[model samples]
Target: MDIESQNSPQFFSWDSLPEQLKSILPLRHSYLIKNFNVLSPFQTTENFEIPQFELDAFVDIDDKEKAREWFLSFESKSKTTMPESRRYEIKGKKVLFREKRHCIHSKLVKEKQGNRELKRPQSSRLRNTNCAATIHLRLELCNIELSHPLEVNLRFTHNHVVNSAESLSFRRVNGEIRGKFLELFKDGHSPASAMYDYEDALYLSATDEQELLVLLADRATDPDYDYIAKLFHKYREMALGDRNGTSMFKRLEEVVNDYNNSGHGKAILQEYDSRTGKAFILCVVTNLMNRVHERVLQSGELCYMDASASFEPLNTSITLLYTSCMVGALPLGLFITSDESEITLEKA
Candidate 1:
């Protein structure tokens, strides 16, 4: 993806940029200069050629903690200012923070599904801009005090105009708000009710979404109802234990442990494809499922399966193998798989 060789690279001296592009990076530098006795001219040396940007600016920070504080602010500000930026950890020492493209330029993905262009993404504010604006930080462990300053860099050219209002969907809802919504939901309040309940206990909007769906909102302010709905869906997935990802699987395992301890069900197979990480396979025969399965075997009753691809957060398909008898269609065993291929299912 690094087409820097084709972009006709342009380099501006760090000193020249303070006056030229100062408005582009409005806030971070003044804070750095005042606190860190900032280097007058950030030496750009060989320019640590990276394919990310047509233009790059480098700065040094002697104080690791302050630099971290600045980083925290910088990242938080992106939620409303440009796009919700995500950090891609490079090895363990550096991070490349870039804007997400919101799965916008996806024509190529249609041609190649393996490209994962439509996957869980960090969306960008504008599409096809290939916006070369980024902030790369050479980091040190924050847990302990470190002597050397981490190298910080930024890319200043944007092919499109940056606007805060365009990034409203990328706004992050705080954990407190999500937790409160979950509590209200668990108490049987609908998503709309949950939002109202949260607001009743906290901030009050003249209209239902007056405060939310704004250009910017603080922790005290609620997020758009869509975010709340997404959280509800996420909660269902976690409870179902069908979602993929290492963290999600670990949580599902906790649920499995609880199920086993309660003597309610036994998880015969709890497996994931570690190599490709594209599949989640689990087989569970609950007490009810087992009883129906045994009755079908003894009575030679009709057995059928229902397949559903609505399993969320991943492409896992759930197939319910059930037996029909006087008691009705009862599940014998649950089959969850990512592969819908004939050979794979036949093997299963």
Candidate 2:
């Protein structure tokens, strides 16, 4: 942590730096002009549809909840701060909730400045697929905000067949898979690594090959790394807080945000260097771990503990408190310490 080591230029490869990489995807104006016709949002006085899909017509329904159910059916997620399946617009007495589902393989939206495309040196997350497959819901509010007739627009004419292999991108991830992925990611694993580890973990946890296949049946046709990688980054920012923060205490603070409390929850034990106020001996035990350890103790099972030094490149020692299970050793507590001293060992 010295100034000389920090300022060293030999720490990384030249090609791996942010400046060396191609930052932005250049607008494919030629392909856009040739393959598609529509670009800007323009409507005529005759065609007064909400989403303005050319071939689709709006359906009328009386119930507002049914309109919401229609929105959720598409698995349409929110691109804005609004929750999924909850986008709406209010005009006078008319209360409108629109659900627009775009084709996954649809053409990319352009970033235009005036008439020309706005080409930037940096990367952008702004997306407009220009896909026609969509739905729009419109409803009117009577006096005292009473229920009125609802209008549902249909443009489910996706460019690709729904059951086709290319359309697999449209499949929604179930809560189980999403929760597991988030858990692994929050435990300091990369997207690719976490995926691989998850598969291995599943395989190891299952009783046999048959059981493994049964567990992985739903995930057999799951979207690959390319699609999940984008979701991973988004989940990291929203679920897990800023991963690039310089403060170690801030990270510990984030960890203890929910997982740890004075009352029976995840516990964090630490030994800090008085000079720098930096935690050198850090041990974390989750609620699950506490429950497992308690079970082991209650069952009068022989528990095992071990300390391994310098297994990682972080110049720290790892202390593991585990018990043998049917499949493998179940880790009850994990500790990362600067040294394998008596104080650190006691804390672990």
Candidate 3:
């Protein structure tokens, strides 16, 4: 390896030449020697010239890690010495796509006898009409903290019923957060205690970039974080408490079943990468129940609790979601409902 070749101008990006040269100097001389000069002593000029001999000295440094380290070291020094504007380029976030829809609640009223106006309660009407929803989610990576950890925040709003056809209505829900850190750790086989740093935890546990974003969204904005975290703790403790307990067995089966049915638990467990590495997932599937019912008997105090709870708490243990651009199964990207949003990361 010729030292001269390592300094070539041809191989340097416009910004790299100065930084690269800084790395070659002895640490003590580069930092401590205030008045020392490599060329002429006691001569100072604000402007610096690129040396012809060093122009062709740039060599291929194939190790990206080493290059990054050198670049960062130079950057740190520049931050202190250079003016603020020239220190670094701040990457601006560009909106990828935005879909907006208006939601208006409609009363489910049977044709009244004659042309008299019929009255109905909004709450009861809300429960009676079978709502089919297509939630639009706005996603933006507003800020990214390099090295230490990535912080993501999601701000959302909603419109009521967009379209209602027959028994189904299409609309978006804007205020629910569906994922948690515990899920990320458990599904990725990482201990919850290992999550001291959010960014590193993400890099270690999330295989796909989308999943990473989803996980961050879950951590930062999901309102149900505490509830989910509690559930995870209880679930984990129960499993460890009795390996063959009846409750454990039932829970495991439910997790597995949920995964097969594209349920919330399973959605959180799937991951994919579009271009880089194979991804693992920790999906936060929400709005687990959607019902379509006929108006049967009229009652003032009917207990409308989950009629389908019997088939609930699905098995989501071995579930995974794959990303496909063409005609494929499974919902892609982010989907929001009138009450909640589900963020899933697929590694491509």
Candidate 4:
């Protein structure tokens, strides 16, 4: 682009910008010049005003629901469905909408002369060169009872020129989409899977996945983790029921029994501390591991043993014996113990 063209007050195509610059661009263009320095000598010197679009104007008397519907219609149209729209006073009935990005305020520093004199160092509170575009909505409600009809008013304002294409791309989960997500959840798909499904259905960007999930969770009346856990428990219950309802320990025992029945291993040995009467060590050396044990024995070098406290399920420790061989490091034996004490190590 020529210097004159670069300096012109012309709109730049969103796709033409590099990926690194896309994120810094504001949703609107009014604050663009103030937030960024124009290096071109012929750059536009005139002040540019942000354009405003009046979405709706309505006053519902004794019909709060109708007024809310009208307000939400504008919200849905603009696709400004971020969770940052907050209800300030439930009794007073007011909702405030603002940009989701937080202002990265400059750190307060004490003056060199006086420690008490603290000051901010920058003209802008937000980090980097991006304009913190302030797009907001204020909904006020007057009166509660039917004695006098409730007065409702919504005012939408923005400090930047709205990007039509980008604004339309914002996600707003309507009833149909929300119902689809709930149906997937009811069908036992995980939250992550449900989120992917929603994203796929709408062709949403990966950056909006978390925001979409948050919106879904709000509609579902459950937190994301809780919803995921519920689905997991449901599937786990089904699996357990199909397997004759065996507990985790019982399943482990069944595997050990099968190994013994096949003559591949003997019953696991349990050694208890005589004074405490608690099983301190549980050792197992299966027939499959016999070759490894023999190799370690033939090498005539003491096998290295290490005990890890993190592996066991029931607050126990696991000890493993390994030896270097021609093939590689071979595991000689496995031991599970209640505690990694001298007695337990000696017994293993």
Pairs with steric clashes in candidate 1: 100-122, 100-123, 100-124, 101-123, 101-124, 102-123, 102-124
Candidate 4 local accuracy as lDDT?
0.44
lDDT of 3 by residue, 1-348 (tens): 123322321333334335434533213211111121122212114243322112112112223344333333432332111111112222435432223221122121222124555353453334222112112212223311212111111111111211112112111111232234445545643333434443464567888887655544432232233444565566566554443344554664567576758644333333223355433344333332211112222212232211111222322223322232233333222221111113321231
Residue 19 displacement (Å), model 2: 55
Cα misplacement distance, residue 108 of candidate 4 (Å) = 46
Q: Estimate, for each residue in 1-348, the C-alpha lDDT of model 1 and write its tens digit.
A: 121223322333334343433333335342222111122222223343222132232334445466655555544443322332444444545432222322222233233345555434675543343444555555444522433235445553333323235433434565556777888766657677887777665545444564344423442245677777888777756654455556667766776787778877777445566685534566677887766656566434566878899665567788878776666676777777777767546545
RMSD after CA superposition, every candidate? 15.3, 20.3, 27.3, 15.3
TM-score of candidate 3 to 2 decimals: 0.16
**Between candidates 3 and 4, the TM-score winner:** 4
- Give the distance in Å from residue 263's predicted Cα in candidate 2 to where it truly belongs: 16
- TM-scores, all candidates, are 0.36, 0.40, 0.16, 0.31
| Candidate 1 residue runs with Cα over 4 Å from true position | 1-72, 78-128, 140-148, 159-163, 172-177, 198-222, 237-348
Question: Alpha-carbon error at 61 in model 1, in Å?
Answer: 7.8
> Which residue runs does candidate 4 get wrong by more than 4 Å?
1-251, 262-276, 286-288, 295-301
Q: Give the Å error, residue 113, model 3.
A: 32
Q: How many residue pairs clash in each candidate?
A: 7, 0, 40, 2
Q: Candidate 4: deviation at residue 179, Å?
A: 21
Q: Which candidate is the best by TM-score?
A: 2
Residue 148 Cα positional deviation in candidate 3, in Å, after optimal superposition = 46
Instruction: Please give, for residues 111-163, the per-residue lDDT of candidate 4 as tens digits.
Output: 11245532446533222212232223333443333232322222223332223
Q: Which sequence of candidate numbers ranks them by TM-score, best first? A: 2, 1, 4, 3
